[model samples]
Target: MDTQSAKDTVDIDLGGVSPCGEVIGDLGDDDMVTVLTGMKLNLAFFSEKVANLRNFVMHLETLGVELEGFVLDREDNDVDVGCVGKFLEFDLLCGVLGSEVVELDRFLDTLYAEIADAGERVTSCKPWQDNLLDPEQCLKQSEEQFSEIKKLSASFERTLSSYKRGGIGM
Candidate 1:
């Protein structure tokens, strides 16, 4: 899909505005810890997000397993080529999906650990395993995660720009 069309699917507009400028401008030298804590908390969401995706992929694998077993259990040696091909294709897709989920989970785990360690220096910004029972809570959590991600991106962009401008003092 083209860029505009792809964006239209979600339908969120930036209007060329970025939070980095506002966030960076609002930060004082003393608020570095706060900023770092916020970033760590925001980044920790990766673990939660990856875990959710892992669950979904594993659920897909379950369906694939059930369907494959059903087809194989039929003692008929003359299965249609199309049906066999579909099962094989589904299995292949499941394998790829499963492997990707594992890799992402591992990556998220490592990053989460690092962020947790860093967060200890400021405050514990660990992401919680949200067991939201109510729909309202779920919606609230989603909005909060989205805000954190946006803030994290803004802070990261600001930091990168600062380093590029020779302000990092390498």
Candidate 2:
């Protein structure tokens, strides 16, 4: 195809098509570099978010352990109605936190997979700057995954903060 026609063909954006679907195959070296750089940035951002979320989850787990210890220590006290009620509340909170940890673990697994896929796409396209690869799709998917994870992280943070204010472990 002629240069003008090639440009026209590439410019025809089809909604729902992968960002790099039609363009990558025809991209020049400079364009490939740009795309690769964007993908790298996306990877970096995703890795940082995942690390932060993991740290937060670890902190929550630690809090749960400490609260459990406190509850256990209180179990030996002389029988009292209020103490029993607090014990039940703490047990429920710990259970809910444990379930949240499990859910976060599952999410982390999926996020890790997305990161790995993005990394692989970047690696595969590095040496040859292969036109057939779809790094943009990887970038798009990573953005989406991180966005959802961020929302979940924020929600959990709010919930934990509310619990703290309510004197959960106090």
Candidate 3:
């Protein structure tokens, strides 16, 4: 059968319910499938980005610790001319890291909004009843990933705050 005819058949089989479900409004099976697949792909892409961000934050934390150590080591010595340049460099680097954390916090906010929107879309589609998608599993996976990102982001924020408080050097 042609695509249009096949869609008509499916619509008839659904007893007036569109294959896309009532909330989605008048989309055919192919369209619904495309949307669902796109949602899954987006979730996976965001999850990977979040993981990379987590790694970046952890690396920053390590750098902060090492810089703290360097500052402590220098504290015992008399202030040398060379130390002024090192302190300036350290201040500049800290400023860069602080700006990056602000950017990442904005990114996390966007991710949270996307996840919430996707969750609403997933729940609205009667996927479990229609056998269109596994809503429970998809939601569970996204929630788990989101929670992990939130926790990591919070920890990074705390670390960044301490760094800002002259934990490395005034």
TM-scores for every candidate against the unseen true structure: 0.39, 0.37, 0.52
- Name model 1 segments beyond 4 Å from true: 1-73, 123-170
Mark the 10 consecutive residues where model 1 has the least summed lDDT. Answer: 124-133
Error of 2 at 57 (Å): 2.1
> Could you say which candidate leads in lDDT?
3
Task: Residues 1-170, candidate 3: write the lDDT tens digits.
Answer: 96569767765444323444554444445655565566556556655655665666566556656655665666544454444454455455545555655665576566556545545544555552343335436545655665665565565556556645653333
Whole-model lDDT, candidate 2? Answer: 0.51
Comparing candidate 1 with candidate 3, which one achieves the higher TM-score? 3
Question: What's each prediction's clash count?
Answer: 0, 0, 0
lDDT of each: 0.45, 0.51, 0.54
Model 2 misplaced stretches (Cα beyond 4 Å) = 1-24, 76-126, 129-170
Candidate 3: residue 120 lDDT (0-100): 52
Better of 2 and 3 by lDDT: 3
